[model samples]
Target: MASVSALAQVDATPRVSAAVTMEQARMVDIRSLVPDISQSIAYAGSNNFVGAPIRGYQAPRCWLKHEAAEALARVDAALRERHMRLRVFDCYRPVRAVAHFVRWANDRADQRSKATHYPDLDKSKLLGDYIAPVSGHSRGATVDLTVLRCDAHDVDCEPLDMGTGFDFFGIRAHTDSPEVNAAQRANRHLLRDAMEAQGFRNYAMEWWHYTLRLEPTPDTLYDIPVTAPTDSGRQAEIERLMQPYDGDVPGVSLLVLKDGKVVLSRSYGRSDLERGIEASPATGYRLASVTKQFTAAAILLLAQDGKLAIDDPVKRWLPSLPKVADGITLRNLLDHTSGMLDYEDLMAAPYEGQIRDAGVLALLEKEDRLYFPPGSSFRYSNSGYALLALVAERASGKSFPEYLRTRIFQPLGMRDTLAYVAGGPEVPHRAWGYSKACDGWTRTDQNAYSAVLGDGGIYSNIADMARWAAALDDDRLLGKASRALAFERQAQVSSTPEATWYGFGWRLADGLQWHSGESVGFRNTIVRWPKQRLTVVVLSNRNDPTPYDLAISIGRWFMADAQAEPH
Candidate 1:
């Protein structure tokens, strides 16, 4: 059951107060202390019962009173010792956001989120039990979270089944509901025990909701906008860093993520210069080699399903390959140690049609020898990924693109991402690629190899890419063992300028995992510091200077002590 104050806040006659000043309150970003604590701020996005971003939630960052934040961090640390984690859905709600919830609850016509959030109860009936006029979250000591079970290495993690999803407006959502199964009840008890040990009390009516036993400011509500840490000055400095893309020409979309939430998302210049459309977060750009990560993930997923294995020889999947590829394994292809010849070099002069994945396989099938014995040395090979895509199709009994859609993209909520193929599916919110000509930028979106599905044909936007990154960080798609295997160092890429290794599709160097993608008219880079739980993505449509170095610079700004690493 909800506390007396919690019920009182759910008054029949709702009221909205003027925004309060936040200058006197000492607020802290929870991630500043608990960097690994996962977040999926429901009110900050359209996934909540409101069906839109609640007012005053500028970003998905979590904030809490200083004492509360420290206590929550302790809880997280204790969970980590047990190979588990705390994933917060809401923390320190704004008074305005609570008002937004109140207004939405009062409106009888809006039932858009009813089927999913409040299936059994009428929308009007939710006001007393769920849609409260005032929320303890505004006091900055309250939180909504669930437990995530993890592997021994704390890599792959998934939320425990607590009978109902976050914000579910039904009795099943009750922490001790008899309607829930035994496992669900035990999971709820597990969460309650951990939280209570840290001086927090759970609201019985909502399994996810919690408040500090000794709240620092129980009566005072905050209206301060929830934003990334030190957002003002840092945002300005980042804007200056991105000045090159701030004009009416082919530009870039930059997304910075920290603690599983967006820290920054901004786009500059025009996605379609001829159409006079400015680039926005939603503008999809060809990911080029960055698509390799997704390709690698698809194979790993198939392996999880018992369709294939990383150590399995390439010949096992694509028997059409000549004897030269007999020594190559899927792991070799992933780590760039296949010694496979580059497909581009094999294409005869003035190749006529766009080459697809199957065509790449055909070209390689005719080759007599690899550059070196498989697994002997590192050599970047686009042909390897192309064959891997075909292998995925053959093993899964589905088209490569179809496997990516149903198995990877759609499952991860990467709705805007796709393995682009001609006449397959039109990319929504497309950003045509560009080349810097003498007079102006010219559209050079596609070339002979544009249709290649595996190596670099997927198109995605920053928003979707963020979702993909989140999946990689959590056990949304791949399990802990699979994720660890994918990121583990397999082959040494370089030993000169700095120690760098290749893992599946990612480059590992000095505690950082990164990769760059370049094609005819797109240059992109995604740099991630897994330990720090930060990721920087830069996507450009114009072919000129590569964005890898720029992406590193942006990442360095966020990292307190960045180590020297390869681009």
Candidate 2:
């Protein structure tokens, strides 16, 4: 079945004497430590010199030896302090992938990428110097990346002008090339300085290449597929910690995930006290303020589709708003720095009925002034998100709920998750909220703002939320660049008891990304430790005890071994 060219290609590939197992290599994904670092893996796709997807790259993930990954995380952390980040192009090359590169280098017939990659050099000259038979990446202590600078608000980010593009096989790609101008050379040195401070030595020929000073496995190559790691133990301890929810009254649903696998999923108590239905992982509970994250995501999706820009002024879309809202931008709304007056504060005493998102917009349209000027300070405003829902509807020309269903939930295979619009579509496996009374728990679910679809009105269960958490890990629904904007610290919440920062819709505290929701009778929270690829979600129907602190305690059990400090 093989042709002469194919047989020759196979013969040119070198044999691998030995390769280490994953456990022996002790490798970790850089994303597990630096969650917000940007990645654009060139070889994993058809964007590189070979002009084809390389073999042995199952996923576009960056894995390095434990020590080297830690060092790279340090470099990323130091750069973030100055509103900068690392955008990696390649890491931890597999032996087979290297073989693919070598085979392509020897084939003189395939000159498709010549103009872009190796314009000045002959293909025959690439084997010894650039395309080596054995690469340091196979040993798992090497990485290729460039620096990116964010705007003053840390919202928009773009890569710096390096002298030459990555993988360019020419003298201009050299780290100390004299052909580069002053600004480009300065940018190159800036990256080198940051990486060298963390014990990385740059290759003199390539500006984007660097390796750890001390390699963990200098001789052996690692061939384990790049995938998320899953631990076998730690299930019983988690169940014991969640024992309180295993009861008869209105209760909670909990899900714990490690490396994208379900570690513990259990629900206790009754979802419907009247019907005598037991709670399970499928019981849908109102997300309350947690819905803000979905609303923010919807806006970002619209931006990605070229419907709107995150930096556009609110008045550009909702022109009927009063002059006080003129300076507010969509970024301010997502960051909760818009300073829009809380619509709840503007509601009449003992409001007659539940105010929908449009009503919230109407109330803001009449307000004369804001609590503060836009982007001047931080104040969580439900009004901001409600207005964003209207913007999403107008931009996409579809109802907010419909956009989420077709674009996000359906694509992610989250069948039961939905935005709760009364009398539109009934919730499946629904759980009614309850509050404690002197005698027993009382039904106290919907309130004046329950109908609002943006600030706090989405329903999901443990299973669906787990899918959402996994989607955030990669660019399945959101691109890598958009994720960086949403995860970056756009606002400083407080510096008191402990430092806390606010990204788009998530809270950053003590190296944990989390958010809590509270309504009339629902209290829920989700905590994520990106460094360990761990997540803990607590969705409760009774409001007596808040689950924010509880979720953090559960997250700590897994992140106890993580060494990277919080950004």
Q: Best candidate per lDDT, number?
A: 1
Model 2 segments more than 4 A misplaced: 1-237, 560-567
TM-score for each of the candidates: 0.59, 0.58
Error of 2 at 139 (Å): 64
Which 10 consecutive positions of candidate 1 have the poorest summed lDDT? Answer: 1-10
Q: What does candidate 2's lDDT look like per residue over 1-567, in tens digits?
A: 000011111223434435455566788878668744566665655657887768876656688888999999999999989988777777887777778888998899999989988899988978866887677787778888888776554423456898777888878888889989989999999999999999998887888888888877666666666543443434434544554553335778888888888877767666766543556678899999888888988999999989999999999999988998889999999999999989998899899989999999888888879889999999988888999999999999999999989988889888988999988888877889999887557899999989999988899999999999888899999898778877789998999998898887788876678888999889999888887889999999997688887787777766664444466
Reference-based lDDT, each prediction: 0.82, 0.80
Q: Write the per-residue lDDT of candidate 1 for residues 1-567, one digit (tens) a residue.
A: 111115423224433334443335687888768744566665655656777878987766678889889999999999989988887778877777777878988899998878988899988888766777777888778888888786554533556888887888888988999999999999999999999999999888998888998887655677788765554545546755775675446878899998899988877766776744556688789999999999999899999989888999999988888998888899998888888888899898899989889889889889878889988899888888988899899999999989999999888788888988888798877889999886568899999999998999999999999998888888889999989988898889899899999988898998999999999989999999899899999999999779888888888777743343344
Candidate 1: residue 45 Cα off by (Å):
39
Which ranges in model 1 have alpha carbons more than 4 Å from their true place?
Answer: 1-232, 561-567
